[model samples]
Target: MDPQTVYEKLGGSSDSEFPTLHSEVARTEGETPYLRHPGVILIAKPDVDIEGLRPFLEGYGEELNFDAYLDDPTPLPPGSLLLKTAGQTCYASFGPKRTYNENAQRYFDNLSSSGHGSVFEHAVFSFFVYGVSRAITHEVVRHRAGTAFSQLSQRFVSGKVLRFVERPEYQDVPTLHKRFEQRIDFLAREYDEVAEELVELQLQGDPRLVAEARTDMRKRVQQSARSVLPNEAETTMVLSANVRAWRHMIEMRTDQHAEREIRDLYFRIFLCLRLLEPMLFGDYDIESFADGTYGATTDWRKI
Candidate 1:
């Protein structure tokens, strides 16, 4: 096919042909609509095998006892226990004189104070983060070290039921809120119209196009049509990171000076991590700001 024919088949020849393909995706009333807040669910964490470590303890020295932790009435959470064990393994600190389960808080505090963070990497956490904006994720993915992410793909998935995230600032102001809603509704309709046009253009009785699979054709159409989607478009992602990386990100992102939307997201993540492994995250002091957002500070900033 000629270049012009191919270009027209793909969608349009130039950006001027599609002026409405700007801004964010939107949703119809019966469909899932705008989300006002982000959400996070801790879906996974480290699970240590205390009994499995017994053989390693014996090989190190008979004086090294893993049974002490196994026999204790109050056992630590798997993530905390794994961190403590990894830290103690460095010095063979497993005997009675070693910091016991009761002193786990102090042990972790020492780890943070001393900037010994390698052991913290042994405990990994996974979260299902949803209803967040693409803008926030653009920042989240920047913390690439010791972190893994599986985010929603706009290409393969249609945005017919797309949802936008309303900024906290706009949500409280009546005029801004109304205008934002109207904009989203208009964009949603625009997305549907553009997507339909693209679909029709691609499938318009061309033998080569007709030969393409239905799913492949849809992917091509939606991928181009999704350019109109804005940073405020709601996206879901699975974020997995080690304790060290999480702490570093939380400390950086939850500062009072950080962007308000992301600070709110990370503060919730910090709370979840603290609940999951208090000994590791207990040093953070969470503060609520006048803007109805939260920030976190810790004496041990990086570690």
Candidate 2:
């Protein structure tokens, strides 16, 4: 199946929790509005080998002089198997076999609820996100901890078919939307024009570049012209972050005050997290509006 469909299935069949915006918000100064569409996709998540971790968990418990509790009847949280492995070692009470039982759930619940979120850092997820604006990524990259990123290079790819993102608020405003398209087209055209000039200069100055394909030379030139690209230009990236980093991102980006385009992106991510690790994410309150919008508060209720 396609990645998009897979992500949708992971989120179950829920309706959009995206929040609706007032028309005026789209027209706010310094904001270029466009239609909002879901863009984030789950590319990869942690694959925990439970048995593989048992020995270490057991050993850690012995070293710490604590016995793990293993008395609950409830099943283990599927999505958090990796987290369970790491968290089980935190208290170091139960032996390896008992560390994965119901008692582990209580331990994780306490750790998460108590704000010792560092344990969650052991579980990581990687995502391939597309159709997001450069503006949105600027905010996302600011998250410096427990995360790694690999993004499409405008210098290499901008010379191909150029794409752009439209803000949701501007979808209803035909004039503004048209203007947005026109501006994007203009920049793309200018990029090509500038690239051609730079390529010619390179060929004249360096004989070695001529031995390489014209495509390579063009790519090098594109690096120079990409400076003209706008923040609204569409881009793709692979973002990998541990569970704790993801929680921080979801909380910060889903706030009411966040930019609408980015809020929508993070909400989709939040849904995927809920599907993957309910016990970890289910306690967070995600609010939805009549207009198909959603967001969450900074605080999480204990599960």
Candidate 3:
């Protein structure tokens, strides 16, 4: 087929790259949506914790004189300095010999391009993400290295407020969208019914339990009923990752072949990092799509 005909057939632009297609594909019920969606917040990042560093550095010497001179007129941010210092410590590469003005930028640029990603481990970031489906977190928790996660517990929280993620595919289909909403509401109502039945059973066993341990019994009942929760249930999580881990995640998850929800998520993360530490993440060439999505290639050939 002609390139234009092929592009039209694929349902995307001529410039866009498409995921590999196959026949008889194994499909999951809760695969991520394939559209631009937003639900990431950069809650915290490394700041100049000068006071915190003072005590540790005192062990080296009482009067340690060190200075940095860079060709870039703009002074480096504290986060950049922190990354450089952490990397330099590994080689005992302090002083003008190793971190000279002439070689300073070159050193960091080379470090990133040469795949010495360990240096980035020193810088960490935290985010608060909500309004995402459980399916998204399932994929996120798989990246266990140099990261930590704390997510909302379905067992403890009451499933009364049943808000769920709406996938992009159904945006234009009002009937389907309404059906999805109704299904969620129905499930939540059923969950409440089951919890009430459990509570009544408990009360029958111990007449005074409802009056004396109302909260405990309710929580127990909800925990049991939580098994029925659907994958579309919205959840929240606080995710923390070091710079190295973030880079790895972005490289792997923001590709054309990655699940759309995760790709959308890490793309937001990439933007956040770029805003906070431009020197470190600015080299990445992130592309903005007409559909309001963002993505990038792992090839750091520019650096």
Task: Give the TM-score of each candidate.
Answer: 0.85, 0.74, 0.74
Least accurate stretch of 10 residues (summed lDDT) in model 3? 18-27
Write candidate 2's Cα lDDT for 211-258 as tens digits: 377677766677778888888877778889888888888888887878
TM-score of 1: 0.85
> Cα lDDT of all candidates, in order?
0.76, 0.65, 0.64
List residue ranges in candidate 2 displaced over 4 A.
Answer: 1-38, 53-79, 95-106, 206-216, 289-292, 301-303
Q: Per-residue alpha-carbon lDDT of model 1 for 74-105, expressed as tens digits?
A: 68988899988888889877776788888788
> Which model scores highest in TM-score?
1
Which residue runs does candidate 3 get wrong by more than 4 Å? 1-36, 49-74, 97-105, 206-216, 288-292, 301-303
Q: Model 3 Cα displacement at 189 (Å)? A: 1.9
Task: State which candidate, 1 or 2, has the greater lDDT.
Answer: 1
Write down the TM-score for model 3: 0.74
Total backbone collisions, model 1: 1
